[model samples]
Target: MGILLLMARERVPRVMRGEIPMASIAVERDAYPLKARLLSNNFDNQFQLPVLFYVGALLAILFQPGWPEVVLAWLFVATRYVHAYIHVTHNRVGKRFMAYAAGLAVLALFWLWLILRLLILAPSI
Candidate 1:
């Protein structure tokens, strides 16, 4: 959630203030600005994908989804957070790509499931 990210950012400033004398935070101040920009860009993209997903979902509450679909959708949301975490924390490119791919797979599968359900059920109307 964006709120969670904001809360996390607030803690960093507080922690940095506490540790300035020791320079415990390893990251450079200038580098953080660029890192932050990349973070925001990813967050923006993540938010947009879910908005479009739910819009399709809203169009067809005629039949609510089963548990797996809902769970997978939630997994996509969690995976996005994981994607951002691996990217900024460990800086592991391979891990970041894996997280991102997992999220995309969930989204794409959810979309296809919703579309097929709607089309198959359309004959009843």
Candidate 2:
């Protein structure tokens, strides 16, 4: 096992030098391909969903739940920033998905928690 691990480690630089199987979606030498263009569009769409949610949360806080709910909503938006960084900068695979999933989970939980809290705890005020 140790020998195999050492072999893998030795290959790491070679992989970075384009020896590895190309798992990248689409790539071109010195040119951004269609995949990169599509990813950019995807980045833009997902970039705003969480932010809009937080703006809703802020409105609810200043005018209508509690501070905690607002924080929860905003944190998800921040997570999307991390997601984009991973997806674009490093081209990392799993990390972007995890960050994206976390952001979505936070958004869903925020909405549910806010609605339930508003119904069960906070009265019309």
Candidate 3:
């Protein structure tokens, strides 16, 4: 959320500088042909895979997930940070995809562990 907020804040100055049109705020489409829309794109990207992260995190907190879960969560966060940096800077699709894939792998592992834990505890519940 902080990252998203920061991106939004940065957009204001860019808009004020006439890099982006005030009317462009109504939609996601970038009107500025010369300016890089890295922040806007990154902000949108946060809503995609990170939705799963939020769900997994809620479940983990509810179930008191183990150290592996915690570690995987941190790994996911780290990869996301890397992804954001790659996305907003060089905008290298290959490198950004790799970072995204790493985060997805971590998230998948975390989900697998969470599901297994739930299955194991289901009988007692």
Candidate 4:
């Protein structure tokens, strides 16, 4: 996504006008203008809660989750798509936050379910 963002930025004539050097962005958070900055921030956001999703997915694979877990996983991915759409587009905080919170809730439930499954399936000492 970061590479894609950089490629997209190159296509924008204004970004290529040399107003803000690309190098500056690495050193300064505010180097990119509003839209570019928002995109950068959104790209950075992919790493946050999604890291947990990756772990949960791995665990799910190892544990052989049922249909319910599969549904929750899809729901979580869907919410993230909605959140990123709102973030990079209109960027209405209220709506974006709702999507974010929904994803977080689903993620928490996913982890909880995984933990419970592990405990229930554990062998007796």
- The sequence of per-residue lDDT tens digits that candidate 3 reaches over residues 1-125 is 76567676766677789877778866665674422467667878999889999999999999887898899999999999999988877878999999999999999998998898788855774
Score candidate 2 by TM-score against the native. 0.57
**lDDT sort, best first:** 3, 4, 1, 2
TM-scores, one per candidate: 0.61, 0.57, 0.82, 0.82
Give the alpha carbon lDDT tens digit for every residue of 19-117 in model 1. Answer: 333353355433345455455456666666678667755654547776656786788779877987776566588998898788778888877777776
Model 1 vs. true fold: TM: 0.61
* lDDT of each residue in 10-40, candidate 4, tens digit only: 4356547877666776567576566776777
Q: Which digits, one per residue and each the tens of the lDDT, describe model 2 over residues 1-125?
A: 32234334544454467754455424632233433443544445564666767566776676455666768866886887788666646756688778878888888778777767766766743
lDDT (Cα, 0-100) at 30 in candidate 3: 60
**Local lDDT at 48 for model 2:** 64
The models' CA-based lDDT, in order, is 0.66, 0.63, 0.83, 0.81
In model 4, the Cα lDDT at residue 93 comes to: 98
lDDT of 1 at 72: 69
RMSD to native, candidate 4: 3.2
Instruction: Return the clash pairs for model 2, or none.
Output: none
Candidate 2 regions exceeding 4 Å error are 1-39, 51-55
